[model samples]
Target: MVQGVDSVRQLFFGRDDAENDLTDGLLSSAVFRPNYAYREVLSGRKSLIIGRKGSGKSAICRRLAAPDGHPGACVLITPDDAAGDEIRRFELQGVTADTAKSLIWRYVLAVHAARHLALHVRAAHGRRSSRAVGALRAFLRANGESDDARLYDRLRRGARGLQSANLSLKAFGIEAALGVNGASEGARASRQLEVLEDGVADAFASLGCAKTHPPLLYLVDQLEQVWTVDADSHALVTGLLLAAKHITGRYGRAVRTALFIRADIYDTLNFSDVDKFHSDEIRITWSHDGLRDVALARARASLGAELTAEQLWGRVFPPSVRGEPTAEYLFGRALPRPRDAIQFLNACRSVADERGGPVITEEDVLAATERFSRWKLQDLAKEYLVNHPFLRALFAMFENSGYFVTREVIETRFEVRRQALHENFPAYTDSLTPEGVIHVLYEAGFLGVWRGGDVVYAGGIQAPPGPGEDEFHVHPCFRPALNSLGTERMTVQQGALLRSDVDGACERLRRLLDRAPLPAPTHTETLGEVLSIETEALRRKTQGRPPTSAQLRNVATHFQTLADTLRQSGHVSHPVTRRLLDEARSLTRTAGGAIGSGQGSNSEG
Candidate 1:
């Protein structure tokens, strides 16, 4: 239950990504969580695993692709940027975009299957390669697919062959290459592809691969690396779906395909056959208990100890942070995903280690919260950068503001920056509107809406914020980074009304400095900064919530003292001095009005 800094340092949560985690990090097949998605894919009951980034889609894909992980052979196909570009730019003159892309995907899967069968017949069946398998080997060599090449290279070759009718069909008993003289381009391509697929299917049937060996499991993951917000991207993904569905049917029980796609990208796809995929879709969701199990599993794997949740949470990490159970404080702040939980838990461990602790303390966890919050905030922006490039700009509206806000308050903020936002991202102007931005924020998990009694984020089956719905809370994951921890709503009382007067007074002072330059440049600069700092501090203190009446009187006294000092020092013009004094008196009167109206204690932030 207790360990030195060395032991704490040795305790690691796996890497953020599954690829690295499996190779050199703490993750291993032993600790893999065989969740519903993994089970469904292995059982061939579901082929689509949809979830947001960090929801463990890649973890399942990587695990399934490992040796001894899948019952049969496994092939993982992850397209790089180049392959994505090839898929996006691919077009056929005689076919719809969807059909055209589907053909390419089918071609890729067929090639991989052919290659697998060419070797499997001898290795698994323990017999001389059958004629069908030989034909597959010949087809592979004839098409330059015999050698190991990058996915992009293979896609490029396949696309060229399909588009120009250059594929070698002689392996299928034809004497020459496929010619494009008989049918339209799409028809010709489809027919040629069908011939190749049939050749592969023949090999599978001849060896009785389906009945003899486990079905070949094909995994397609990380499509988001090449995903974009365009029609071509949509077609690319749609084609993948169509191709995966076709593989299951075309090869009968010989081949199974699973596509791990981001939820945002998957939700954008629309096609007539979409309904048919309903049963095949399995969304990756993580519960708090699920995440805790994962953490404990990984902890045991890393530390070589079967630490219980009680020991891990109580001895390793603090039992409580900020008066809440440490587990709740940690998991409740993170997006309900494995990666987020891993990163947060690792951060706490790292902080404790850095402080030379035998075990993590409440201070360590609190310090880690700030660092984790900043990471999640920036990561949220990067996660949506491809689809929503203007996301980072929107964070400024929330910085230093309250975590809880109403639609009206957000709209007021948005209206101030509407024109500039449109100009900055003119291409996305349609989505830069107040409603559009709200939806984007909500969908990205930066903001959660209060529904019923609890706040619900975007990953659930809930609809987006409705027109009639208004209350929103920033996800706790991003609160510390934005310095927006206050959650109480400010009442519409005199303290709230004085908030604007205080802000206006500060703005007036800034404008006066802009208009009047003090005679002594250096001294003026020093004093001006001091005055500005004070004003800014007050403004931030009451930024998104009401200022207390006592706080306003303090501000009024500070402003009057500052104005009088500047006048005595002869660093300000008489006009500026008079304006400052007037503003100070105005704040004083506002503070008196707030207290006299019995509104001083009504508003709290």
Candidate 2:
């Protein structure tokens, strides 16, 4: 069994088949073998393997190319093998606009030729004949007229002779083609490619013997890297797809190509006329179950013991009270893609390391979960702020409200602020305030729906499950970072002045109403006029009286109307007003006073 730093390092960092064997040995009996859409690919089909970075896409590809004890027959060609080297060569050649197109063409031709050589060596089993000779002759005849004709001819003849002597063309020719002997490199490469293609065709023809299998499978991985560096990489990919389709069709199932590509890149392709390509191919999506199985298989291989993926996961990270082990619970509500699971595990490991623990624990998982949630929230914030400015004002409201905010309270508070601002500075009549800002914050994940029938600031907190399997809560992960305008003294001063105004207004309105009783009126209009007169009289008599009892009632009715309007407009319901009304009713019942009789009494004070 492997042990210690070197072994662990090899298990984690080794890239080729040898390393893979160790990994498989370590994990074989556990449970997490990659469930690549292998059946479809092995059945001579094309597919895409899409996943984010570190999603194990590369690992899955490697597994398919080199399964345990299997002399991997597949030829894996990556963009790095072709474009990476080509880009440096172009820079060395002093690339310019005039030569860019030629450089691209050469790059594509080189990659295709390399792939051709690999296929030839795999199929030919070190044999050469008239077909290989004829292909070399044809290549020399065509390209020999170039400036490097003599060098080309010599390399071409040498490559053909190597094949004739039963040597692997790929093993013998690639280095010669790329050798520092600049004068002969291009010609030699072209000649090697010509012979390689002919050898491949001839080998396939021989495979038509009754004892031989009909088709050979070629697995290509990391095709997405081509397009990442170059906008025109799509053309190369399209060409490869078309060529594969052609060979598979012409050979009548004698040869197959299976390409592994990222799903997002595949989606970006123009597949409007899918029938133009092989439309009957199978498509496989790696789901949560598939990822879990891969992890389990890896674990089994590592431990050399029987263990299901779930069991392995539980061993690594047991469930916690704060979160369950459901797939959604582990990887959020979205589909648990391969990358997400791996990242979560990585995060758990990181937390464990930070806390000086050798094994990952449930607490580590929980902490990682919160970290992931906060990252998502930050992403949401960036998206909201960049795409929607109106949300900025809404976010500010929640930030300033100290956690608990209701829609009605926000609207009422904002409207009052807006009116005051309008009166003070008619030039700036906009209603941008803290209340309005809270709404924006809600959309940005800083606030979300809470169980208390109103919105609450998320604050990055996650709720641990309580007794009876309660739902999650808006657990604060970190302290809020919001602009708190004005000092404590300023806030206290403002509150004192506002309270004094309110008290003075209440006293003046009470005296005015006591002095001028409303005259009894039969019609609604006449009663309204009497109430309006009393309201005005109260306003004049009091130093800061809001209005008469009738006016206060009118204002309350207006607030209710506004709340209804906001609800109709799709704003969330406000619980603050309802609570205020409930409190008022309770106070009235306890005091043995009429419901509307205490309006002039400064009960709020």
Candidate 3:
């Protein structure tokens, strides 16, 4: 039987690589791993979830937040996901970094607490949770609830309507949130903050009176995004940590806050009381076995009852020419991150689709390397763009160069060109020196140093520094993406590396995945459409073109799904709910009409 994109997607078993376990509904999703890390965070023993990107940090937070038979409410605070809640708007113009961050964090905590407290009224029915919060309503008064669109929806605005008391509380929130004030005003707000915290603590303390009180789980994610601006980024993350630690300490019985942060960022961050924070930290790690399990789980999910986990993976990944399971040939190409494994597998599937083969062949696996490498290269750029603003120039330094280079050649290769720039310039790295540039590249996973015959990918301690460390090879995975020494976009396809090869490889990936029409999306605005539009957009983005017709179709499809989900969720308290589905389906119709070639269909998007 012939296999292609449709078969590959069918094998996905409803798994969208683009989605997080949270919105993917982790509670019911088969990717659930009831491992130690899950238990530790769920039990409130570890508040910090640290991992490299795509290592399942978000999954852990979403899992810990599962409300299925879980004792308490879960208020997930992904600050970036919430529109209108900019970190900048919360900052004060004239305050110490610590004070400004603390005040913003405090206000954020209070608003979320108020929102969750009211929403969790059902759990608090036999107890005085509502009364405890209501009694302190005066203290909880804040003005900014209206600005936060999410506050109205998630905050449970039903129990008490637009009464003066609720209005007063909102006003109080606004007052508390306006932390940009004179020193004296700041002091006054601090006093009000103390009272609010005391009230929340007291309310949580009284929650034990309930039949089976669930601990309030606050899953805070996307802390990396908080680094959007570094001016006081460190202070901002610190304040969040301190705020969670302080508040959760008082109400440990009823409150558990888990913060998901990037491992690389966390490793380099400096803050006050850092050790204490480190003590309770849990790292999200991935091993060969664990990642295999993840792949098997996904395969199991896709194949469902037709094949068990082992059977599905066995069929998909047979023995390769190397006399090893094709799984190793595929998975070994990646670092131990889910993103790496998933992308590698996707690339293999794409090649198999391109070949019209039901199963991935050895040649298909080998050909997929160039594209997979390109993805990792872009992944590096996107993830590190903020932290290392000048990383591109560093990457360009590798263009056209062959696999091996000495430290002197690397420094000489880029230094004369690099050192001319002002030290303060964003593109200039003073550390472009021999040792420094080597370490930076190693850490970025773009290059690896060699000791005798073994390659060292790590930049820290394990890095080969002594005698034979002077020479290294450009990490083979990165070779396909780098350009020729001076030209741009001219990728090396003639068994030689070029600067432009990486630029063009990902476009090929798009074609590989975009084969065949998608199945009919359940919700007009389903994740399927989003993935479709986004996938098509990837090629255009690389070519520096605008969104293509396929992308618009996807956008419309996604909007429809979202509208349907909102309607079916049955809790459309927002005014938009009245006509949300109609507007969404309208978009679906409009978007569906844009695509040509009979491409737009309920089952084809």
Best by lDDT: 1
Choose 1 or 3, whichever is better by lDDT.
1
After superposition, the stretches of candidate 1 with alpha carbons farther than 4 Å from their true spots are 3-6, 180-182, 486-605
Per-residue CA lDDT of model 2 for 1-605, tens digit only, reads 22222211121211223234435443232233534455545444445444433444555555556554113345455555445334323311322322332323332333333334334543554544344434433343433321222322333333333223222244323433332344333343334444454444553455442125434455556655545423345444544555455445534444556666554455445533446654534434455566656545544444445655455455444644255674445644222345445555555556766777645666776677666554543444443432343443333343433333234445555665565555654533442454334433442335444444333333223232222221111223211233222232443454344334333433443344345432233123323433554455454335321122223333333333333333444432334223223333443333234344232332322
Q: How well is each residue in 397-428 modelled by candidate 3, as lDDT tens digits? A: 67766565656567677666665433645444
- TM-scores for candidates 1 onward, in order: 0.80, 0.45, 0.66
What is the overall TM-score of model 3 with all chains considered together?
A: 0.66
lDDT per residue, candidate 1, 307-390, as tens digits? 788889888887899799998999999999999999999999899888888778899899999999999999999998888999
After aligning candidate 1 to the native by TM-score, how far in Å is the CA of 27 from where it should be? 3.0
Supply candidate 3's per-residue lDDT for 151.
32
After TM-score superposition, the amount by which residue 290's alpha carbon in candidate 1 deviates from its true location, in angstroms, is 0.7
Cα distance off (Å), candidate 1, residue 333: 0.7
lDDT of 2 at 390: 44
Instruction: Quote the lDDT for 515 in model 2.
Output: 52
Q: Model 3 Cα displacement at 468 (Å)?
A: 8.1
* Residue pairs of candidate 1 with colliding backbone atoms: none
